[model samples]
Structures are given as structure tokens and as C-alpha cells.
Target: MNVLVTGATGTVGAHVVDGLRYAPDAAVTAASRDPVTARERLDCATVGFDFTDPTTYRDAFAEIDALLLVRPPALSRVRRDIIPALSAAVGAGVEFVVFLSVIGADRNPLVPHARIESWIADSGLETTFLRASFFMQNLSTTHREEIRDGRLAVPAGDGKTSFVDARDVADVAVRALREGITGAYDLTGPDALSYAEVCAVLSATLEREVEYTDPSLPRFLVSRYRLEGDLAKAGVMAAIYTTARLGLAARVTDDVRSLLGRPPTDFRAFVRDNRTVWT
Candidate 1:
């Protein structure tokens, strides 16, 4: 089966490539806008495919059997960038698609994932929707500096989240692509933890007294995210915090362990394995 994985250089997509490369029956193609640069970055075969460009969609989808579809966070124009590409791929007879959706997307109409999901259902293309939870990687990337400084600052209001590992999501995605599983599945870590609990875990792992601070909007926007005076970006950040605060992301599911037949990597292991990043 020829599998085309979009967003191939991203954290989850790259792991999908890594997992599928070992599948004897699956031929993996990493999709990117620039094949030359993509080829240099990815170990697998590369094709120049951009979500914003319909012209690039056909050639990349041609003769492709399966696809791991993910809407890049920055691409909010779902009807424009996503649907057209999906329509082209389906028209080209691509058999199945494994869509990387998010937790509570079905209920949250403001986000693009739900709209994309609705479009896919209406498209009648065989599909599997992986509604993955908050990524544990947020610590290592988006919220790392605070951890290093022994403080966890956010306006999440003590709501909990079941953060899944991106690698685990990728593993499930590869299985869906290869096995041709079609349905909506929730992939999450074993535990749902509040930011304070999260700090406790990190403190235990790092042997430091990390504290949690529910910072005000100005402090978080200007100091934490460093997007001062950028209302658009700040608004997006606020929406994300609202999602967490409303407890929309706190559900823990065994989908990863059920699919992989192995336990999902917990937050402690994640913090331990990526210890150097915090220090």
C-alpha cells in the first residue's frame, strides 16, 4: 500500500513515518510543499504537496492507497485548504484516510477539526478519526522555560488534561493506515492531571520545587507567550486555555493501549526521558 503522510516533518507526522517505514507491506511517502527540502529532512520518499495549493494535491494523491491527514494548526481556512485537497484525493480514488482530529472536536464547532470531520463524513470516503488529547510535548516546547525556572504558569483554572504522547498517536495512526481501520477513536494518556499535579510530577522527576502560577492575561501574553500586543495570537491562546479550563480535555481513554496492546507512556516517563530539555 502506498501511504502519503501529510505534515511529515511535524512531531507526530515524523513518528508516523518512522513507524510505517518498518512495515513490509506499506510504502511511505512524506508529503511537503518543497520536495527538495523535504527529501533533505525526511528519510523516506518525498513529494511536493501543499494544503493551500490544489495543483500539488493530484500528483501526490495519485496511486496513493492511504493517507494520514492532519490540519496544520495555522491553517484555519478549512473549506479552502483542507476540503479541496480531500476532494481531489477522493476523486483520485485514494482508498482510505486516517484523520488526526482533537479531543472534544465533535462538540467544539469553533475549531476546524469538527468541520473537516463533517466534510469527510459527507464525502463518503472511508476514514478513521483519531481524536488525540493534549500532547505531553507541550511541556518540552510551549511551556518549557517556566519549568526550567521552577514555575508553571497558565490561566487554565486548575482544570485537568489527559495528555497523550505524540509518538503514541503516530503509532495508532500507522496501524490505522496499514490495517485500514475506519472509525472515531480517542487516544489519550492513562491519567488526567491538573497543572499543579503536572508540576508535582515534574518536581519529582527533576528534584526541584516547581510551583504553579495562574497568571493573568497580560502576564501570560507579554511574558510567557511573548506575543505582546498581538490580539489575534493572544485570542487563540486564550481560547486554548478556555478549552482546558472548561474540562473539555480531561477525559482519559485506553484507546492507545487497546490499539497498540501496550501501555501508553505516562507523564512521568515523558518528563524523565526528556529531562535534559527542562534543565
Candidate 2:
């Protein structure tokens, strides 16, 4: 059962290494600080882990039994040194970890996602916390230049968001790393719209006219782009329009159809299945 999928070519760690590629006896291992862009987007066998080199995580934790941990959205290079290189890979034996937390992670402390969910709930290994949401592939990776300039612009006014499906949060983080489950799963989306109903379902799945512009959370964090640095970005534009002005990420949850049996894909089927990455 050797997992190890930390941001291995991201967007839910490339669908948790393509849903653990049918796990014949599970052995995935695609950690990455670019083993040539995780071996050109991960077929597998790509290493070089780099949480700013905690001596490259003992050759990416060698026989790494379980890990799927992806908390690297930069936040000043993981608030200065990747949570002690993920608590020194649970003191070098890295048993089970799965964390990809978000969605008001235990009430966002200026969003380092509640300091990486309190360092994976005080890391003593065996954790789960997937908690994902707000990622309908950020309309083709980080709001693709405001959906290629048609403007689904910022400061999220109506704020509601249940948009989940990054390969259904990588098939529920590869089914909590092949069934070692544990806790915290808020992985949303079966519908909870309102970024003006997700720009009226991306203007009817890219028929055009995609405009949801609400400008002032520090002027949409100075015109957002990878939410520009210096760590506050107006406290992530006042916690994403105060989670859509206190609708609190709307609601809608069957916990991804009770953990991926089905039914989590809407955002108008993720804009008619990625509408050519927003026209």
C-alpha cells in the first residue's frame, strides 16, 4: 500500500495519481518538486520532494506507506518552511497522513488554512482531513486570467461556493488513501452556487457573457492573480468575500455523495466539462 502523493502534478495531486491507478497492490509514489514536472505530469515514478529541502525528505520517504498531503499553495513558501517539513515526515516513518484541508479550515486564521489544520491536528501521524471545496479547477487553473478575460472578476459578492470536483477531490483523496479513512471530510458540491450562480453556470457553459464582477475587497485584492503574495492579500480578500458575505460557502452536502459513490460534479458539470478551459 505505498502511497506518497504530495501535489504530484497537482489539481488534486493529478487525481490522486489517477485514482491510485486501480491499485493492483497500491504503490504510487509521485512526490514532486519537479522531477521534470513530476515526470511530465505523472504516469508514475517521479521523486525529488522539496519542502525547501529537509534534505529532500529522505529520498522522498523511501517505501512511503501513505501520504497524499498537499498543502503547498505557497503562502510564503508554507509560512516559512513547510510545517517543519511536514513534522519531519512524522519523524521519518511516515505512516498515514492524507491532509488537503480547506473550506474555513477550523475557522481560517488569515488562511494558512488554519495553519495547515493545526499541523495536521498535532501530527502524531494517522490523519485524514480532506476538507476540500472551492475548486471547480479554478476555472482551468487559478481563474485562468479571469476566465480568459471575460471577467468572473473578484471580491466574491454573493460568496456562496460549494464547487468541489477536482476529480472529485481526487476521488476523495484516493478514497482516503485506499480506505484508511479517519476524519474531517467536508468535501462539498452537489450544488451550492452563487458567484452569481457561478456566473450563471459560466454563462450557460461558455455561450459567452461570463461576468460576475464585485470589486472591493481591497479592490479585489489588488486585482487578484494567484492571489498575489505578501501573505494577506487583504486576508484573502476578507476571507473570500467573508465566505460569500456569510452565506458561509452556501451549503449543499451529501459529503460528495457520502464519499464518492457518485453525485458531486455540478457547477454545470464543471462548465460543461471544462468548456475548452473557458473558451
Candidate 3:
């Protein structure tokens, strides 16, 4: 089966590539905006693809059978980018889609994942929604600087989130693509923990004290904007944290075990395995 994996450079997508490496059925194509650089980095067949650009879809989806769609967090305009890409995929005769959506995306309209998930369902193509929880890799990427400084800043209020590892998400994606499973699967870690609890785990795992900074939205937005120089993106990010702060993203699910036939990786195990990144 020909599979096009979007966001090829990302944590989840990279692992998807790794999982499919041994899958005899999947001829995986890693799709990124810069196919030349992607080829060098991913060491796989690469194609130039962008959700925002309709023209890139034609060649990228050429003879493609299934899609592993990962919306880069920067792209927020679902109506403009996502729907058009799905339309293009349909036109390209792409039959199956395994979309990586966020946990509670169906109910939470604050983010673009919900809208994108809706569009995939309404597209009449066979679809499988991988409703993933907060990624455990956030410690190494988004919150790395904060974690390095001994504090993880966010506006999670009193909420708890099940932080699933990207590897598990990718493994599930590989299976769903190969088996062509339809409907939705909520991928989450075994335990649901608040930010404070997460920090405790980090402290224990890293053997150093880590604190949780529950900053206000405005402060987070301004700080992130100053750091990233993108107000719109920062605001969108703030809204995502705000939604989690409202206790909307705290649910834990057994879909990972059900999909993989084994228990998903837990927080302490993730931190222990990735300890070098923090140090």
C-alpha cells in the first residue's frame, strides 16, 4: 500500500516512518514542504507537500492510497488549508485517511483539529481519527527551555492530561493505515496527572526539582509572542492551553493498548528514557 505521511519531520511522523520501515506492505512516502532537505534528513523517498498549497497536493498524492495527516500546529485555518487538502486527496483518488486529531477535538471547537476531523468525516472517504492526548515529547521541544530552567509554564488550571508518547501514536497510525480501520481511536497514556503531578514525575525522573508555573493567558501569549515573534500563532497556542486549563483534555483512554495489544508508555518511563535531552 502506498502511504503519504505528512509532517514527516515532526515527532509523531518521524516515528510513523520508523514503524512503517519494517511493515512489508507499506511503501511510505515522507511528505514535507522541502523535499530536498527532507530526503537528506529522513533518508526516505520524499515529496514536496503543504496543506496550505493546493498545487503541491497533485504530485504528492500521485498514486497515493492512504494518508497519515498531521496538521502542523502553526496552520490554524482549517477551512482554508485542511478542507482544500482533503478535497484534493479525494480528487487524487486517495481512499483512506488516518488523521491525527487532538483529544476532545470533537467537542472542543477552540482548536483547528475539531474542524479538520469534521471535514475528513464529511469527505465520504474512509477515515480513522487518532485522537491523541498531549504529547510526552513536549518536554524536549515546546517546554524544553522552561524545563531546563526548572519550571514548566502553562495555564492548565486544575486540569490533568494523559501525556501519550509519540511512538505509541505512530505505532497506532502504522496499524490503522495497514489494516484500514475506520472511525475514531483516543490514544492516551495510562495515567491522568495534573501539571503539578507531572512536574513531580519529572523531578523524580530527572533527579532535579522541576516546578509548574501556571501563568495567566495574557502573560503566556505575550511571552510566547516575544519568543516566537508570531502573535497569531501565540494566541492560538494560548487557546489550546486555555482549553486544557478548563479540564477539557484530561481524559485517559485505553485505545493505545487496544490498538497495539500492549500497554502504552507511561510518563516516568518516557522521562527516564529521554533524560539525556533534559541534561
Candidate 4:
């Protein structure tokens, strides 16, 4: 299998690239804007790919059998940026596509992932959609500084979220790429946890008191904007947390265990494994 992984250097995508290395039958290529850096970091075959640049598409998709398609967070205009690239992939004879999508994207047409999923399905190409839940890495990466400072603040209210590990999501994605699995799978962890419960786990792992400041929507928007210095990005994040606040992100599923043949990693296990980030 000749697999090309887009967003190959990102959170889940990086792990996907790493997992594909051990798949004997798969020839993995990490697609990046900078092929040189990607080659050095991932130590794999790479092709320079920019979604906005049509010229880069030909070589990126050339002779590729399967594509691990991941939408870069910065690119929200799917029709303008993603659809063209996917069209190019089809033209280049790419047979299978494993799209990394978000949970509830199928029902929510407002999100860009839904549009991409629709386009891929309409393209008549064999595809698998891995609709993953909230990533546990968010705490370690996006909210690391806050957690390290002993406070975790978001507008998630008392609603619980089923956070899945990026490593597990990557494993399932690799399996889909290699085996050509068809159908949508909702990948989530074993339990749904509220922010307070999540903080408790963090406290246990780091041996320090971790607090969850359940800020109001307006307060969250202001704080996030102040932290990120981008109101647009902050607004997007607020919307995501709003969904969590509404209890829309708490669904747990057996797809992870069914796909990986093992139980999904729990929040406590994830925090324990990555405790150094908080420390």
C-alpha cells in the first residue's frame, strides 16, 4: 500500500506517520509544506504539499494508492482549499482515502468537516471516516501552560467529554489505510469526564492541585483572545467548548476497542503517561 499522510507533522497525524513505519506492507509518505524538514523529522518519504497551491498536488498524489487526509486547522474554507486538492488526488489515481474527521460532523453541516465528508462520498472513491472525539492531548499541548500553573479554564460547564488519545486514533487510521476499512467509526475513550473530573485525574498524576475554572462564555472568549491574540481562533474554540457545555461531546463508543482489539486509553492513563508535560 502506497499511503500519503497529509498534515503528517501534526498532533494525530505525526503519530499516524510513526505507526505506518512499522506496517511492513505500507510505503508511507509524509506530506508537508516543507518536505526537507518533514524528511528530517519523520525520517520517511515526503512530498511538498500545499492545499492552496494546485501545482503541489500532482506530485503529492502521484502513484499514491491510499491517502490519509487531514484538514489543517487554519484552512476552514473547505470548498476553496480542500475540495480542489481532493479532486487532484482523484485525478492522480488515488484509490482509497482515510479522512480524519470530527465526531458529530455528519449531523452538523455547519462545520467544514461535514462538507469535506460529503464531497469525498460524492466523489465515488472508497473512503473511511474516522470521526474522533476530543483529543486528550489538548491538555498537554493547548492547555499545558494553564495546567502547569495549576488551573485549567474553559467554558465547558459541567458537561463531560469522552477524550480519546491521539495515539489510539492514529493506530485506527493506520489500520484503515492498510486494510481499506469502509464506514464511519466514532473513536472515543472508555469514559466521559467533566472538566472537574479531568482536573482530579491531572491532580493525581502530577501530585499537585489542578483546578477547573469553569468560566462563562464571555469570560472564556476574552481570556482565550487575550492568550491567543486572535479573536477568530478564540471564537472557534469557544464554539467547540460550547458544544461540550451542551453535553454534545460526551458520547462513548466501542469503535476504538473493536478496531484496535484493545481497550481505549483512559484520561488518567493518558495524564500519567504524559505527566512530564504538566510538570
lDDT by residue (tens digit), candidate 3, 120-143: 888898999999888999778888
Cα lDDT computed for each candidate against the true fold: 0.86, 0.75, 0.87, 0.90
Evaluate residue 55 in candidate 3 and report its C-alpha lDDT on the 0 to 100 scale.
82
Residue 219 accuracy (lDDT) in model 2 = 65
Ranked candidates (TM-score, high to low): 3, 4, 1, 2
lDDT of 4 by residue, 1-279 (tens): 899999999998899999988789999999999999999999999999999999999999989999999998767878898899999999999989999998878876656788999999999999999998889998899999999999999999998999999899999998888888999999999999999999998998789999999898899889988888877567667767877888878999999999999999988888888899888
Q: Which pairs of residues have clashing backbones in candidate 1?
A: none
Better of 2 and 4 by TM-score: 4
Clashes of 3: 0
Question: Which ranges of candidate 4 are over 4 A from the true structure?
Answer: none
Q: After superposition, how far is residue 107 of candidate 1 from its true place, in Å?
A: 1.5
Between candidates 2 and 3, the one scoring higher on lDDT is: 3
Clashes of each: 0, 1, 0, 0
- Which parts of model 3 have CA positions greater than 4 angstroms off? none
Task: Kindly report which residue pairs in candidate 4 clash with one another.
Answer: none
Model 1 misplacement above 4 A: 216-237
**Which residue pairs show collisions in model 3?**
none
The runs of at least 3 residues in candidate 2 whose Cα sits more than 4 Å from the true structure, single-residue gaps closed, are: 3-50, 75-132, 135-154, 158-160, 163-171, 174-176, 179-187, 195-214, 222-255, 258-279
Estimated TM-score for each candidate: 0.91, 0.32, 0.96, 0.95
Which pairs of residues collide in model 2?
A: 159-244
Question: What lDDT is reached at residue 29 by model 1?
Answer: 96
